[model samples]
Target: MTYTGEVTVGGPPDTREAGDLQITKIAVGPMANNAYLLRCALTGEQVLIDAADEAPRLLELIGDGGLARVVTTHRHGDHWQALSAVVEATGAETVAGEDDADELPVPVDVRVRTGARVRVGSCELEVIEIVGHTPGSIVLAYDDPDGITHLFTGDSLFPGGVGRTWSPDDFIRLVNDVETKIFDRFDDDTWFYPGHGDDSTLGAERASVPDWRARGW
Candidate 1:
């Protein structure tokens, strides 16, 4: 689905705020990848996730520069298509999963591992590595002060199921990791933002976990 262009072309058309954190979503590139802008309301420190495509548009969203960093969730080319452009334009520090760092076009200033945290002002997002999609796929989880949890799941968990896997073994590993690291950890209210398409709640997707595993996709 093509985004309204309200967000992808210029600024955020739909922005969600909770406690001290704010999230804005934009769909860009041929794959309709979802790029996110996460901001700390109190400190105004912001971080961009995915950088997907359309360098000029992504740079515009970053503006003059309150951007603290840019974190690529995985190594897929589409996910980092605009990485170099954004880095050159804003000089923001780049971060990526340690396992996928070498696959990225630009060098990653910080290598992230499971349990590492990325701070956005007063709030923080904890990284949880979920392998299988690309071996370095990760999901960022932030627990809000208001009792809500927000997750930025790269290509790991999607609206309906886990990310596409090449084989049965890959599918099993992805599903198991997601169940152990994610499903067992968070509650129903946790909101997850995927690499493509709309957001979903952990509660909304819990029932399908069994079905997803059985299908082995």
Candidate 2:
């Protein structure tokens, strides 16, 4: 039921939980990168979104979620500096885009790309490749049981504004893509959780897209 590429240092088979999808955030490393643990409601199977640092805390939270996977939205060490420690906890598979697989901080067990789904029990996630902040950056979207779309934007979109392109060309492309691709897809009320800061909705960002573009941030 899961894609197993090369054998990696860690990975646990997916285990189903009998509750609801639960999301927990643990701030890791000096940068305060938010590491998220998503537990499937139907199956306790869980996935760690990031593992920057603070191994002790991350482990404590994932105590029994049967952590099966570690996923990185981009190549930044800030997003997965604690790869070794997390792997020890779950022996879980690691996933990232094929484009940047070679550059991954740790070995990858799964290489995913646009339109592919990463499933956890009854929950299925749609991957949206957003390549401005990092060459292999992605935004994960899933429809909760409530039918609400939730976006785990990684370092992509954020409250008040979008992520700054590390380069000029990346910035222009990132901005344009947000308008033409993302905004056109999600409803205004969809919730967004960036790699950092407060969560916001697509509508709020859409209303300010013009201003954001004009300010050139």
Candidate 2: stretches off by over 4 Å: 1-19
User: Tens-digit lDDT track for model 1 on 161-215?
Assistant: 9998898898999999999999999999898898987788899999999999998
Leading candidate by TM-score: 1
Task: Output the TM-score of candidate 2.
Answer: 0.86
Where is model 2 poorest over a 10-residue stretch in terms of lDDT?
3-12
Regions more than 4 Å wrong, model 1: 1-12
Which pairs of residues collide in candidate 2?
Answer: 10-91, 11-91, 11-92, 15-45, 16-43, 16-44, 17-43, 17-44, 19-41, 20-41
The true-versus-predicted C-alpha distance at residue 12 of model 2, in Å, is 26
What lDDT does the true structure give each of the candidates?
0.87, 0.73
lDDT of 1 at 189: 89
Best by lDDT: 1
Candidate 2 at 202: error in angstroms? 1.1
User: What's the C-alpha lDDT at position 137 in model 2?
Assistant: 83
Collision count for each candidate, in order:
0, 10
Whole-model lDDT, model 2? 0.73
